[model samples]
Target: MWIVSALFAAVIAIFAQLTIPLPLIPITGQTFAIGLAVTILGLRYGSLSVLLYILLGAIGIPVFSGMSGGLGIITGPTGGYIIGFLPAALVMGIYLEKTRFTSSHAIIANIIGMCITLLFGAIWLKYFANLSWPAAFTSGIAPFLIVGVLKAIAAALAGVVVRQRLLSAKLLTTKTVSH
Candidate 1:
């Protein structure tokens, strides 16, 4: 599980490079990675995975977006969004674990997690970047809405499929009954 979690964190780092840089926050595939991780790893390990990823980035390991890292990056304008990943993973993991891991539930969990991340990121952007609410929304949330939804759907489908496969192979287990 630890190996898998670290690998997923590395997957996030790789996706982070797939970026479209914006004025404030770049659009990247990290969110997809987050959704995939939470849906696949479940609550306990998913949260740990995200937490480990954050710690890696915080220690200047260049695991963050754009190959950047260190406390400065985390404390920078976009840091809030980065920090928000933890809670987002935790919430999504918990929500998904408590319910059936169907496509619908997965999508909803991802959406809720995405919202939590956006909320934290936007508020942090407002304060850290010295931007107003509208400005923060424009920079942090607005541009990503459509892409976010698409990512959520993709994550749901992929997570469910992969998890089912793993469970069939006896490589994974879930609290819920076998689907």
Candidate 2:
């Protein structure tokens, strides 16, 4: 489990580097990876994997967006989004774990998780970036709406297929005993 968690954490880091620089927060593949991790790993291990990734970045490893890491990044303007990853994973994991992991359920769960992430991120942006609510919304949430939904759907489907494949291969347990 720990090994898998570590691998997922590493995967998150890898995705984090796939960034397109923006004014405030760069767009990256991190969220898709987060959704994937939670859907596949479920609550306990999924959350733990994100926590592990955060810890690694917080400890000064270059595991965050743009290959940057350290306590500074966690406290930086985009830090809230980074911090938001934890709850996002937890929410998605819990929902996926409880439901049948159908396409609809998975998409809905990931969408909810994405909203949580945006809320945290936007709130943090308002404070850290010294922006008003409107500004925060424009900068933080607006840019990601369409892409977020699309990514949520993609992540959900990919996660479900991957989970099924892993289960069949005995690399993962059935949903009931997963994690």
Candidate 3:
């Protein structure tokens, strides 16, 4: 599980580089990778992956969007979104774990995760960037709404298929039992 979680963290770093730069915050594949990790790894391992990713970034690893990293980025304007990934993954993974890990449920969970990320980001932008609430919403959430939904859907479909294949191959367990 740790190895898989580490691999997923690396996956997130790679995806983070696929950025379409925006003014305040850039659009990146981070969220898609996040959704994929949660859908496939479930609550414990998925959240671990997110935590590893954040810790790597916090320790000066260039794992964030645009090849940026370090504690500064973790405390920067876009930091909220990055930080929010943990809770988002937790919620998403929990949702899947509690219900069915179907494409439909994954889609719903991913969409909910997206909103959580945006909410954290907008609030952080408002304070860190010294922008008004409306300004934060405009720069942080507005531009990403449509694209975020699309990414969520794609992540859900892809994640479900990949997870099934992994399980069939005995590469992943049905669930991680708590110690």
Q: Which candidate number has the best lDDT?
A: 3
What is the C-alpha local distance difference test score of each model? 0.85, 0.87, 0.92
lDDT of 2 by residue, 68-124 (tens): 999999899889999999999888888877877777888998999889888889999
- For all predicted structures, in order, the TM-scores are 0.94, 0.95, 0.97
Higher-ranked by TM-score: 1 or 3: 3
TM-score of 1: 0.94
For model 1 the local lDDT of residue 95 reads 85
Model 3 lDDT at residue 66: 88
Pairs of residues at least 3 apart in sequence or in different chains that clash in candidate 2: none
Rank list by TM-score? 3, 2, 1
List ranges where model 1 is wrong by over 4 Å.
175-179
* Residue clash pairs of candidate 1: none
- Model 3: number of clashes? 0
